[model samples]
Target: MLSSHCLNDDPWNKFPFTGFVAMISAVLTLMVDSITTSVFSRSGKEEPHADVASAYTPDQEMGRSHHGDHGLNLSDDKELGSTLQLLRYRVIAIVLELGIVVHSIVIGVSVGATNNTCTIKGLIAALCFHQMFEGMGLGGCILQAKYEWVKKAVMAFFFAVTTPFGVVLGMALSKTYKENSPDSLITVGLLNASSGGLLIYMSLVDLLAADFMGQKMQQSIKLQLKSYAAVLLGSGGMAVLAKWT
Candidate 1:
């Protein structure tokens, strides 16, 4: 994709391609996270458990409600906060999945549209390893979300199909689509840039921040260091793949 775009005589010179698409992606992710958080927050607060409510007498319930309005017990509050945090994490995982799907599709289409066998071989190798690691990360997030089996299957199916679907679309359009064309450059460049930004934001802010700052990591310095080292190694490996693809 970069090679194709470069053939168009530096599209970046005329357009602030990177910054524009990145800003759009950042805004999109922020909006999604904000809306999801607000909706979850309101839903979490408004629902009351009927079983728990039934356990209390009217007078005791009233007193307890009053106390809850003012303050909650430390342990209770901590438990409630943990539940809410998990809920938020599930939402973030969904959003992250969406960004990754978009990226996967774009890359798949680009790879499928190419005619060079040499390039195809290299891309196949790079993408195989790329998807393997990427899948592990995404699978971890989905597992953490604790989705039902059916929902998990559905998400997995969608993730699995996106690239193939893109490939199909690219093959269908291969006769007419010119990757180096001005139109293709603009469209593909923007899509790639936006997806890049979205993935970066989701990785750092949603995935990394939540785990690294969570209680388990915070309590263990050695674990934190090991995790950071793992992150760097994984990131560097992906960066190396970028050179080939």
Candidate 2:
């Protein structure tokens, strides 16, 4: 119920805003990394199922040669590369969407739980900015995924409602919900931690590594360094926002 292991409170009871829990979180994250890596390695040998809804777009179709092509020529390096990029985009997009949706839900719940109108306005503002950037990134990925209209509409709908859904949930529970209760503490804290981990991994591996370590970014040291600086700047901006928000 608590993370306190301190001398007086035996910090194990209320550990949050503490280093011990942070270490445990890191350990948990490490465990997640290892487990996922092992599973991915084992599955790597197996063929992946193809999604017919987003199999290939007209542009991909046009990449084919005039010769009687019995099937897709993945033999063409450029075409193969493009296919890989599209797959990468789709995967990252889904992951990012899930992460942001969870995050929005949490933020919305907090806002909904609060009765102060002034605080609500600030929270709503933050949520808007947060979702705006997330939407831009997710939109680009979905575009690359080339999903059918129905699927795209579904994603858009979920993206639009995630925060509102959470707010409604919070309001519904407000009658009996106790934010200071142990259950609330653990539930919300763990949820935030999980979303944070997912976002971190997706940004680092699915995005940065996939791009920076690719032939494109690897070709020019100057471009790579510039990208690094840009990322650092972005990190600082988020850090400042965290300080206040």
Best by TM-score: 1
lDDT (10s digit) by residue, model 1, range 1-245:
43344545555566666777787898889888989988876675565332134334589657655664444667456545655665676787798789879988987888888888887888888888877877887898888766667777988998899988888988888888886776777688788889888888888888899799999999999999999999999889888878866
Q: What is the lDDT of residue 218 in candidate 2?
A: 92
- Candidate 2, residues 1-245: lDDT per residue as tens digits? 23522223544454454344445554565565556545543443242323432566567556553535554454454444554555555656666787788878987787777777877887777777777877887787788777788878988888999899999988888777776666776677667776776767666766678779999899999999999999899788777766656
As a TM-score, model 1 comes out at 0.81
Task: Give the backbone clash total of model 2.
Answer: 11
Clashes of 1: 0
Cα lDDT for residue 92, model 2?
A: 60
- Whole-model alpha-carbon lDDT for candidate 2: 0.68
How high is each candidate's TM-score? Answer: 0.81, 0.73
